[model samples]
Target: MNKNPVDAALILVFLYPLLKGFLFKFSSKNMKSDIEEIGGYISFIIGVILGTYLTKKIFMIHQDGVYAKIYNNIPEQIISALESKPLLIYVLVMPIIIFLIYKVVQIIIDLINSITLYPLLDSIEDLLKGKSGFVKRIIGLLFQLPKGVCYVILLALVLNVLVIIGVNDTYNKKLNESKLYGNICKNIINPITNSKLAKKIPNVINDSFKIVIKNSEDQPGNESGKTIVYYNGITLSEGIKSNEEIDSFSRELVKNKKTSKEKAKIIYNWIGQNIEYDYDKVDKILDNDFTIKSGAINTFNTKKGICFDYSCLYSAMCKANNIKVRIVTGEGFNGSNWVSHAWNEVYISEENKWINVDTTFYKGGNYFDSSIFKLDHKDRKIAG
Candidate 1:
């Protein structure tokens, strides 16, 4: 009188016909065609089976005992299991499930066509031709596929809703399960760190740093020039340190090299080598500012640009290095109050100064003179 074996076997067989027929009927009505009806039915059955299996597997891994331990106890166990499995398993399984579901639907369509629809079509036509008694029977049978599919779908939906409502406790347990949570995290984190996407990080970081420095150099004039140009908008602080990009760059510089001064020197040289001053380009100003990353990338790719290009390149490079950097804009020499200019100020820890490093003039190897650093180059604005 063992009930377990009998119950399990009966459940499996009963489910096969009940699910298959229900899905077939539901699909027929909704799809209004035999092919779609068969496909829908098979798809529905496969989906339910796979979904049930997954839910069971998850439940087994987490839930313990009949009276189901408190919610906390179940999730704690499941989380512990996921950490031990390799990431590939998760990646491989998802596609397989999708394929299986598709195959199941295909098989079901073939079975329905061969066993039911072909034999029934002749009778259906005879009834339509006015063969009284046979006509009623054929006509009724003709609507069977569509009606069946609808019934199946409705039943399946109702059952699913019931399970969701009834198994609230189990669902809650699964949600809080550590293994489930861990799996979610692993799925998100592993791809980012180990995939091709991670390779782009270094380039992004490097470019950001280069642009910041380049933008700083594009600012016009020496300290005394009548056009006291600002980089982006802010007047260059006497040693240049004010924003996040420069500060972060300063830290990275110290970490990567012997001193902040050495890092600053490399950044300074990069700007000087990359940016060039263009007077004709300045006259046709359109936009007041440009982004460093896009500017540097474009300039490097095209080999031609204006001060805005330099400013954008320098700002982006500094950003890549996690430095606090900004593009400043203000008045320049010759009473041209609207003459656009760009520059940067980087923080140097050893000197405890935000030094102004003009890559444009610095590239020209002009001697550094404090006399050229004029205070009249007022800060008009700032952008990062």
Candidate 2:
């Protein structure tokens, strides 16, 4: 991701209006001819810019270190093979490629509807009247040309000049420096800021903390297994306050017994059943705690978060149950510009492999059930 606020702000300034315009014109009944709908093409162009901005933001947030690692790891043979592949194969082989083409086609369609069809139709409506003064007719014909062309041209030139000035100015040099400094802060400060209670525990227990401290008791050679157990125990403790609470919840759900999957299912159902999607509420809650500890409760109570919140919470809950989990964030179906989405890869011990879990759609109470969690791991390249 570029991490340039000017670039992002410029993109948003252009896209928000364009996308909104496209949607409005496309659905409006007042648009009788295509030429008058030139406004719609303007909107589509904005959408493209907005989509680009979104893609960059997502990549920055989710795939922090993955890109550098991938670049370093890329083999000469692999690069050669990739480079040698025919361009035509992109249509058949890469889903992301195909999706990009579709988005381009959509833009083209909007352009045609706005510039060509709408203008011609509006002109036809004017021409249908047989009588007019010669000067009046000439002025009307000039008016038929697309509106705001001169203004747009001037705006573009001014923007280009400003960009050049900003790039050259010593004052702007500080902006890049500040940006780099911010990135460093994010890399170092973020982990400490976000670390949970479990992550703070020492290898050797001093009996200061009240929890079981499983890993510390287990001696040397068996340390790794004990660490996993310890982390898993911390996760459970954080998830539910007490074993009594867990037992009571389990008994309420069934007559006698409950497996890990059953317990997970219960949590999943509860989240979906309780939480409503409320963005403002979620943002307000998260503004207080940036840690992963703000999981299902954040989602359930606030009822809003982007896909990241949804998947992270799901993974956290699975982890709480001693289930090993990995969170995957990537572009979804259709080359949708890889906007941020998150889902979990759960390790089912009985199956001995990771399986995908999407809690967002699940939480939506099946409103988005169709094709919701349909992402394939093979389709996703790991982002940090």
Candidate 3:
């Protein structure tokens, strides 16, 4: 009557080593060999995980300078070709680093096991020479438990990833029916991932990669043949990436705010007061000198950016507070003349409607959820 074939399969996988030990008659030599094999596999898994962690840390801390110096000399054409797929950099570089670290750790563990570990086990076995059969079997099972647990953890991780990626609805449903998998994810993986520390972990991976989907219909302000690239499920001007500083700062800014409207208003005030309009960069951009970098990270760090930067930073902060916001590109009347500009449209859950916000013009007037916002701002394209 139990509806858990997946759990049954997992249980068998977990007991595979114990069954192996039984088949080998629980000899000290066989037990020692199995433990050594498990140790090696465990070491490899640790290496892979550590390698991935360290690689992400290294990139987060030193990606800008290191990446520039290393990739600076590449041909512009090649760089341009790869620009459309920035995710490729992580895909190609991360694996090599992980493999090297994994190999090094595996070799060290192998050497240690060969030279000292096996001999130590043999010595222990000699001392327990006259142990009762029951005791020996219990010890053997105890030794095999690590391998069994490791297999279960690894399988749980794989299944969790499959569910995240949404490979197949039926497959995911079946995997979810496994109580063992659910418990491991809920009790172990989820706690670790949802912890405050994990929440604050830099969006380095997200920053490095943007999932792009082309918009077919023609929209104003968005140039023809341009693909819509998204970062963290929000539409953004190209090159706007988030980081740990921005993530933590955004959360801190909204920690005390009660409502989404209140959070959005306070964020608006902070940006207006803190982020200075970079007139020089704006002039350069207007002159077609597109060398300056501007985005959420840039604005958060330098406190200087134009309309696009303002809107991107605003969207990122609002998103951190669970507020639905999108970067809207259009023409805004700048007193003297209407010019190409970017702003935000925030969805207020209380009102069940989207409202306009232009943090760039925050200094001039109340641009946060104000009716006057529509008078100067003309609608164009919402970054999808």
lDDT scores of the candidates, listed in order = 0.41, 0.40, 0.64
Please give the RMSD to the true structure for each candidate, in Å: 24.4, 16.2, 17.7
- The reply for model 3, stretches above 4 Å from the true place, is 58-83, 86-91, 176-179, 186-384
In candidate 2, position 241 carries an lDDT of: 31
Ranking by TM-score: 3, 2, 1
- Which has the better lDDT: candidate 2, or candidate 3? 3
Task: Tell me the tens digit of each residue's lDDT in model 2 across 287-366.
Answer: 53223333344554465444545554565555556666665654331110112244556666665655555555452122
Question: What lDDT score goes with residue 236 in model 3?
Answer: 60
Better of 1 and 3 by lDDT: 3
lDDT of 1 by residue, 131-248 (tens): 4544444444444544454443434333333332334544323322323222322342222222322121111110111123333344465443334433333233311332454445
Give the Å error, residue 127, model 3.
3.0
Write the number of the candidate with greater TM-score, choosing between 1 and 2: 2
